[model samples]
Target: MAKLKSAVVFLIFLTSVLFQAQEREFWLIDTETQQKKIVKDSVSAVKFLDSLSKNHFIFTELKNVKKVGLRTEIYYDKGQNFNEAFVQLSDSLSSELKIEKQFYTKNLDSLKKEINKKYIDQGFAFSRIQSKYLGKQNGKQKVELTVVKDQKRLIDGFVIKGYEKVPSRFVKNIEKEFRGKKYDEKNLLAINRSLQNHTFVSLERPPQTLFTRDSTNIYLFLQKKKVNSFDGIVGFGNDKSEKFTFNGTLNLNFKNIFNGFESISLFWQRNPDRGQTFDLQTDIPYLFKSNVGVNMNLNIYRQDSTYANVKILPAVYYHLNNRQKIGLRGTFETSTVMDSLYIQGKDYSKKGIGIWYDYTEPTEIELFLYKTRIRAEADLLSTHYSKEEITAGQTRYFLLAERNFYLGGRHYLNIKGESALLNSENELSTNELLRFGGWNSMRGFNEESLFADFYYYGKAEYRYLVSNQAFFDTFLQYGELSSKALGLRPKLYSFGLGFNFFLPIGLMSFQISNGSEFGNEIRFSDTKIHWGILTRF
Candidate 1:
């Protein structure tokens, strides 16, 4: 009797396992489209609902498989109406799938990210996905999804908040660009930055956007920061050649001179042993909505007390895009040496077509992970002599590249390189020499310490933020001078460490540096303190 009972129990357990292994029919129906999807089992039905969650169908529920005779039916519910600003559901569905067309994806996380990103980019700041399954309907599994689109806002127009002296043309120009457009945060930030960079105006506060019904408006509260501006700088240092040196520069700017996006700048500088200098320049932006502009400058300065240098530069440029620009530039320079030097004066003129590209990837507040700029130019140079009746023609090429990187935490880095080549039919003069040194170049060397017919310099700086507004930095500078006629000069190298304090009003730095000349002995020479101030009116 006991053996017979055990055999019957085993047979029943085997039948139950076989029933669980058999496939079941499951259905997922869209509440809006009434589209039906047939799944193989409860697991497959759950996965189908998971895919729907990508298209803002967050809340989904599956019903237990009901066995009616030999068949089982599974059901699900796609919850709510989450899409409001769309003309078709497929549009949002494609975005959720991360594709250009309506397609299916097996990646659950990717679908979720795409759906969330789409909602956030479309101004659905408080949107969420909620799902639930409420029983079966019509012998098919019924599932529902709920998408809560909290705020779907659009851009309407701009309103001037305060009665400030802002030009109507400026306001109109800004409005025409953003009116009736989507509320894109990136574009709005860019516009705000452009307005802040304006020379004659300052925003009392960042422009605020107001939303009403289906539209939004930007409010501009403005004040005249200044119509005229002035800035000055002073420095004192001793060079290896010269005993003591003092330098000072002053700039005076007049904005909106012609009332059509034009400005004039006057600059003056005094260097005790070198000479006094004056510069006048003006620039005008495009008026026809095309990215075309012109700039002109005239500079006259004395160098080394024995020679006076005058330069005039005029250029025209057209922006190709946000990162690229093409320009035509000319340089006319002349030198006069009546103060009794070995040679008289020289004149050089060059005209070139140049292209410039800049790219920046900001990773955090006032920080960037990648930033780079490339400038390359080709020019035809004409050289003239004052005392000697000699004229030379040369073709020159120049390239400059600068890059910066932020490598997490306090680590910041900057790298720069510049090179110039001159192919001449006649001998080149000292006036055409490429030079580097001093504060802007190799910090451990004197001003223009190294000069050559063709020269290249490379610089790298690594900074560690020691405090909220202070940086401890280390730098390495290298330069090479190559002259076919004069033979290759010795390479230059410099390394230094410094502390930089970025104050609220200006930047101050103190550094001690060691440098080598001509790959010879090493010494610490250029230990100095530098301060600079810049304020926007």
Candidate 2:
């Protein structure tokens, strides 16, 4: 974004005069030396032309003498018998005209001053302009330019490494975005955005390139930095009946395959009403590039001074893309509940192992000028649903997609659509299906707070940012997921608003909603608004 902005600025600089002003003659004044030499370098020549537009010759007041001629002997020798000159074609001596000329002349001198300062600014003692030829014929002039430029310049190139999840050829395609280009640091920064658009990379503000290396290579060297992510959440919270505590997830992720395609993290949350939770997770990717990964999770919970469920699960997955993935997963899980002494059924289901493959693809119809990512998945019984002799045939199909448009600088308008289905004997239900609501989802809703079976929802979020200062986000969600067993909902709706403060201190968020369950009768308290703070290291 920064790089694109600068390119726009540069283009505007070139067009500012051309956009509204008439062309003029080149008033040749040799360099201030005993044997003045014309500029011989393309870079310097182009810069000199630009500087001329800002020099005294163009923007300052012409001397009081009313003659039109080039000044040859030192400064402003208006009375001239000169070797070279650029006389104004029409010598209208009106004060208004002179005032305009003076304004232009003053601007030119200012530009010259800036050009002289650029050398020092760039750590260069001397700048030699190399294109020196100029000619005129048939009342038209031709200025010479050089094809090669040898000016010393510094640029942070785009870096690529450890992309094991993607084919090298695909990475090569992204590398082409920066190769052999002029190292305009500002433009490079903006073009780096292409990384976020790619389906494979996790979205984040990319790291800057290390400054020391070969600046001229087809594949430039850009050393990447480590990544740290913070998750902030506030919520009405859960079916698991957790409290109204602020929940947060801290993720420190990596893109380079150097340390291997793996990630690890620790999590803890507390609430006044509900119990608390401490969980740990680890995931490994590149399981054959079809988006396969291994997920392990263990959670310890307690409330009212008693032990809650201590659940453990290890799941292997195969996801095709950020929008979709298919995996044949097997998990060994066990649990213990806090208040289960009088409970008829076990607080948790014993270990159940199964393999499921799922997939998603975008539908052709465009919404918000974009198509929805369509998907479908089916899981057959690789094993029993439990130690008991019963097997579950699970299948689900879904379509979800989002598109955004810029409202102004930092403010953006986002639109989304989603739908899904679930079949028999599946332990995962509406409560487990994830949607856009928490950190990285709906800024105001709790993480995984609002989703149900066989449902459809849409959301609009307006996010604002102030460069390095902070970012603010607010969104509205209206949709529900339903399931028959949980009496969840086939028809549900919620519309809410929320915000986040993305600052150096980390992230803070708050959200509120007024809606009901997916059923013939909508219930209240079934909905509420909330707030939270979260960060990571």
Write candidate 2's Cα lDDT for 1-537 as tens digits: 234334433543454345334332222233332332243322343344345434323322122211123211111221211112222212332231232221112232243344444442452323432233255333333223211223544432445544334444344444544454444544455455434333234334454444333453323233333434445444554333534444444333333344334666676655424446677877665544334577777766554443344556667776443334455544343333344452322333334344444333322211112223333433332223233445455454546566566677666676766666645464542223333344443333445444454666777766565443344555666665665545665444556665656545655666666555445453353345566554434
Assess the local accuracy of residue 264 in candidate 2 as a C-alpha lDDT between 0 and 100: 67
Please give, for residues 1-537, the per-residue lDDT of candidate 1 as tens digits.
234234433433443466776654545555456677775654555445556666755565443334444344444456642331111134555466455542223343454456666676787745675434444443333333345777776667788766454555566667766676656676578667656534455578988977666667888876554455565656566655646676655778887755555678998865434656689998775545556768898988666556667778787876553345577778787776655553523554444333333333323322222366677877776766655667677777778887777788878888988887877877765655655555556666654555567878898999888776677888898887776555657787878787766555544556656566674876433444344443334
Q: Which ten residues in a row have the lowest lDDT in candidate 2?
A: 71-80
- Which regions of candidate 2 fall more than 4 Å away from where they truly are? 1-137, 141-191, 194-261, 268-279, 284-388, 397-404, 416-419, 425-453, 466-468, 471-473, 486-489, 502-504, 517-527
Off by over 4 Å in 1: 1-133, 136-142, 146-242, 247-263, 266-277, 287-290, 320-325, 339-341, 344-376, 386-390, 466-468, 484-488, 502-505, 511-514, 525-531, 535-537
Question: Against the unseen true structure, what C-alpha lDDT does each candidate score?
Answer: 0.61, 0.44
